[model samples]
Target: MDEAAGSPAVSRRIAPQRASLRPWLLLMPLLVFLAAFFLVPLAQVAMMSVTEPEFGFGHYASIATDGFYLRVLADTFATALLVATCCLVLGFPLAYAMAAASPNMAAAMMIVVTMSFWTSFLVRTYAWMVLLGRSGPIAALLDWIGLPHGELLFTRFSSTIAMTHILLPYMVVSLYAVLRKIEPSLLRSAASLGASPTSVLRHVVLPLAAPGVVNGLTLVFVLCLGFYVTPILLGSPREQMVAGVIGQQIEEFLNFGEASALAVVLLASTLIVLGLYHRRFGLDKLWG
Candidate 1:
């Protein structure tokens, strides 16, 4: 009886083997659902990429050698990078303001960010369409200022701006989360020690916020890589993104093998970004 009494304490200190099993048990249904609906379909598409055109890798070869496809792929990656940078630049200040604000003010700012984030994707896209249109406020202002008008829409500028706006909230939220964790006393201490605001930001705040910065960049870049609607609706024909090219292949050319190959390439690019992000910052850091 004495030994059994101690056994309960021992068992409490030693985590059970079933502890790991419980999480897997909980995840089992989600894994099964994903396997059925997502993985299986994805596997079918990947299989078709090589199999549909008589078991040759001709589709991939075309993508590798073709100038137009290469250009679109290059543009897609460059645009993603640009948009990610824009989001960071725009969100960092906003996030810092949120972190530095009074509680009520921060809450209000967060509500605004949340609202922007939850706004319908199509609505935002169309709003840009209206804002950049020939009869829109932007064009009207340009005309009033006696500058060139009607050159705003259907350009890379419009598409890039729209994508940056759409993704800015992700960066702001990431930065806000990390910044909020930083004890206010730290900043106050730095200031008390005669550290200038810029110096404090450069030395202390930035280092602490590095993880959030990386996460934000990763999210925005990966999301932008597959972005289609804004580019298609607002970008010029010459500015076709990889996704737009994939759509063109399917809709206009009726080429499934090439489209699947393009899709596989897009997936590979996304995975590569995520892999780099994981290497630089442990994947667990993002979720945790």
Candidate 2:
């Protein structure tokens, strides 16, 4: 009986069990960290949304019915859409250039594109304030051209431009990853088959690059919805985004319930955008 208990069959069974548990053991730390820091705080905020001020869903009800909250929600979605579009428009050409360049040149261009990440957000925001001020280089250029550049500092245009600049790197990197993987032979074959440059791009390049475009657009749009600094500093006070309103409610009114409700709404909106993307195209291709 003792020899049978220590037999090779028993060892094999035990080894498989230990091997199967290894991955979960390795992931235990990360799981614990997320549960403690992220899940706990999120659960607290969700609880506060209904429990604060009263044990009811009045804050969410107000958000659904109130004109100011509805308008802010609309504005936030619109602004996110605009920024995502702008990033795509501006980043695609640059990313194409990077993909088409020599290795050294591509690396240099990538460095230029990614340099913005090295700067702190506050510093970049301040730099924009200086550049968009009445006496900045852009205004000076307009002055030289004898064109009026009225109020470049605090407007939707400024906010949009700044957000576009900040988010452009993400779009470019996404496109470049997919574009770099394209086979030159395919493009050559299209051209060899009498396809015009535009036709080749329309038929071959864009389709292959679609995954990257979707990834970039989704990433930038979700990020823009939660943007707090650039819009607050550069945007018009009247045209407040949901994030700005959330901050204002917490800081000024001490309205924890309203702020928590707004935060939950913003998180839900982001998740909905991602879910739609996943439904259309599997999320596994998000990296491309």
Candidate 3:
């Protein structure tokens, strides 16, 4: 009887896994909220993708076969890639400067970089409209320079410039986070070893900053994929992105199933990109 009382089975029975459930119990409210809001809405979207017009995958099939749908998807991806590349090219130098600056200077620069967040993106979009308008500063400058100023507003160039400006901060912040962690001593050491400035940057700086680059590009690309307002307002009417196409389907045509299918495709594409990145570098290292 005494041996049985102290047995492992007895111990397990006494505990009854109650302690193990405490953390889950604490998390139940958050889990329930997510299920009620996010999961339920997403499930509805998925269902509508197949079932709204009738219980069929006709919308997806149409999307697969339609040249318009394919072109929109291709354009969306190309725009996202362009925005990401532009942000990287412009942001890297600014971030490097911030990382190399004195603490006071860096803090000031960071404040400036992050100031865009304080304003509404819609407002910023309108501001771009004003700036790119026919008699705007850019056109005025061109006029002053004796150059022909073609239409800047309602063009791909306007949209690309607006998106790059809007998304530049994300890239800058990501690169700054990584670049700031790099030790000045290490750079000095590399220089002391007879490594040229360019070589040190190419080998040491870039490799260390690669994670930040990937993180920034991923963020900008994914966010740009679903961009609606800026693209619609600033982009060329002839070149419609997937998001714009999805909105038009729902708003103009009242075709929820088609819109839902487009949304699902966009979501799946985003997930695939994230999955590939996770497989290559692991998602946890994104912010590191």
Candidate 4:
């Protein structure tokens, strides 16, 4: 009997090793692709950032000493934070409605959101330009309503609005996925236990939905940091993002070293934020 028991224990120990090997085998192609495409190019960019023009940290030094570069970095973080907050404020209720809707209604809402995604990003940005320009329908409507004539395009407000529009769908989808798993009976139970609707939401629902909120905010913020097209088409020179700065360095200035340096900074900042989010909120909960 001891021998039989020990045999099962040994098998259990070996089973995990076999299972691990299977996943690694399955992931081999992805691993090879990441090494070839992502790792190799990243290493090349890092090398270029440091050694492109006379080496010895000049590219990094420019980022530290130049006020213009520092302002660009600040603006990038500011815009990302603003957009993420806006998405959260606007998306949470929408997600709740979708999650609570009938299957048919939810499916219709999903189709509309998916269609928005399928439209070309460039076309979307340009469309906003046409809608918000001085001679556009929105501008004309405001004038007809006796409002002061305003220039909406090529401003920070337009940039924020366009980014919020583009990113709101992502936020809604993330929240909806998590909200769906929350049992409706839980809310009913809370209400039956003398909890007000507001109290149930404040104490139970918010805590349960936090993981999704964090995930969505992190995703939208990171995407906002890298935004280029909307800002380029609808924003002023002062509203230029880090991506715009990098583009100018490459295209107009022809300064590969500076461009590589900016790209590295952007990459490092994104990874740092992701690391902090993971540390604060065990990323396992995202899947859980």
Q: Compare the candidates by TM-score and give the number of the best one.
A: 2
- Write the residue-wise lDDT of candidate 1 on 1-288 in tens digits: 999899988887676765767999999999999999999999988988998867989999999999999999999999999999999999999999999999999999999987977889999999999999989998998899999655898988999999999899888998998999999999999999999999899989999999899999899999999999889998878988999988998999988889999999999999998898888887776643
Candidate 4, pairs of clashing residues: none
**Order of all candidates by lDDT, from best down to worst?**
2, 3, 1, 4
TM-score of each: 0.90, 0.94, 0.93, 0.88
Pairs in steric clash, model 3: none
By summed lDDT, the worst window of 10 consecutive residues in model 2 runs over 279-288
RMSD of each: 3.5, 2.0, 2.1, 3.5
Point out the higher-scoring one by lDDT: 1 or 4: 1
Model 3 lDDT on a 0 to 1 scale:
0.93
In candidate 2, what are the lDDT values of residues 66-153, reduced to their tens digit? 9999999999999999999999999999999899999999999999999998989889988899999989998999999999768998
Clashing pairs in 1: none
Over the stretch 1-288, how does candidate 3's per-residue lDDT look in tens digits? 878767977788768677889999999999999999999999999999999889999999999999999999999999999999999999999999999999999999999999998889999999999998998988889889999867999988999999999999999999999999999999999999999999999989999998899999998998899899999999999888888999999999999999999999999999988889899989886655
lDDT scores in order? 0.91, 0.93, 0.93, 0.90
Model 1: what TM-score?
Answer: 0.90
Give the C-alpha lDDT of model 2: 0.93
Candidate 4 achieves a global lDDT of 0.90
Model 2: number of backbone collisions: 0
